[model samples]
Target: MIWTFVNNTFEPEEKATLQTGDLALQRGYAVFDYFRTVDHVPLFLEDYLDRFFHSAQTLFITIPHTRSQVRAIIAELIKKNNLPESGIRMIATGGYSPDSYTPVQGNLILQQQPLQLPDMARFERGIRIMTYAYQRDLPAVKSINYLMGIWLQKQLTEKGLDDVLYVQNDLISEFPRANIFIITNGGTLVTPAHNVLAGITRKKILEFAGALLPVETRDISVAELKNAAEVFMTSTTKRILPVTEIDGIRIGSGTAGPLTRQLQEQFIRLQESVTTAPYSRA
Candidate 1:
């Protein structure tokens, strides 16, 4: 089942006022955010919503709903549909423009669908990753323009890899769909700085692991990763996954390291503590 919201009401599609070409064809002109819930309860929902609004502001797109309004709509949708665990997506288009270069108006969409988790064994055994030379056009905002990820996916598939990690000038930037992190020989947790999207899960891990170990946000080079003690990636869907190999080269001992497992355990415990109350029946 799916629930879609448009113009502050449940709908199957957008309003007739929005031009199809302007909203669908135009690239590099929109921003979006995705989040998942454990059991009909949104995880770090406020953080995700705030980022969504901020992204629209940064891209000069007008969000049709206030932050509180959006939150109320989401809660309504979750309750009406009896959604247990689901993924939510909030999108804002630059709207119908006379010409591709101009922005005339804006539209907002909220979509929710059942959540699906990847195989747990992949996290334990780790997955293969290929490196690609691609960088997101607007690193700060989560936009619909994803040609880079599409291209890398095809290339990585042909290379027999599960995913692709983008590199710029031999410095590891981020994975096509997630953020990258590595444990150096000195036990420092190193990940790319502000050039990539500030992921919600990444932020939580940084906060959870604060001062427990050295954590540094800086540009990590490909060579440094090749010799790192461990490597992993984080996202809303995949909380913490170890990268046992990159480009067919084994990472560390080719297994999920102690630190990665510890973080994953903590993440699960945190999720269980949050409660989700169903909407009261009328």
Candidate 2:
């Protein structure tokens, strides 16, 4: 029986429930952040918590627990669930609204479940994605509004695509769940800089990839992306996944490039270091 943290109380997952009038249910108004745990230790948990708080603030929803209190709850949940390798989600939803529109004190719910990281073959073979011309509302906030992305799943299955890369005005923005990166023919690394969620994996890549190659965050036109020497995406789950093809056009040699493999190795080393080290807020 899995344990969940809901409404300031710990309960069996089967017994956990939320009010029907929650804004998250009626209006789909909420914010969430997710991170994985390895060896029973939450990876980059502090960063995830900070982002959760920021998202809740941006949505005008209040999380009742303090930071330390939230941490305590998470630790307790992990203890009860006993899932060493797992994904943890922290959600703050606009509380039960009397009128079903106005925001009230929100509910902070935490859940844990076993996680399966992508296979090594996915990194080796890479993925193909289709392009879509849509921008998310309040792209900076981690809101519970994935309507367009969810609705496009049918197209993805029909088209045999892995994901959607969002673009606007001929400039590439991001994937629905990840951030895109490109290696120019001239050997420079580039990613989008505006009107997209600045993901934590994207941030860490920027920190380390600079030492490996020239890195830039700027608008990348579709023409530039299609013509790039290599392409890839970064996310909490996907990590540094290569984009072998875009819209049926192969990127470079149609496989993970040499530079991408190098960065992937570097990312794994960083993950191992974090996993073995003592958990710290620093």
TM-score between model 2 and native: 0.97
Backbone clashes in each candidate structure, one number apiece?
1, 0
Worst 10 residues of 2 by lDDT: 273-282
| lDDT (CA) per prediction | 0.80, 0.90
Local accuracy of candidate 1 as per-residue lDDT tens digits, 47-77 = 8988898888888888877888888988887
Indicate which candidate wins on TM-score: 2
Return the top candidate by lDDT: 2
In model 2, where do residues sit more than 4 Å from their true spots? 279-282
Question: Against the correct fold, how does model 1 do in TM-score?
Answer: 0.92
What lDDT score goes with residue 215 in model 1? Answer: 93
Model 2 C-alpha lDDT versus the unseen true structure: 0.90
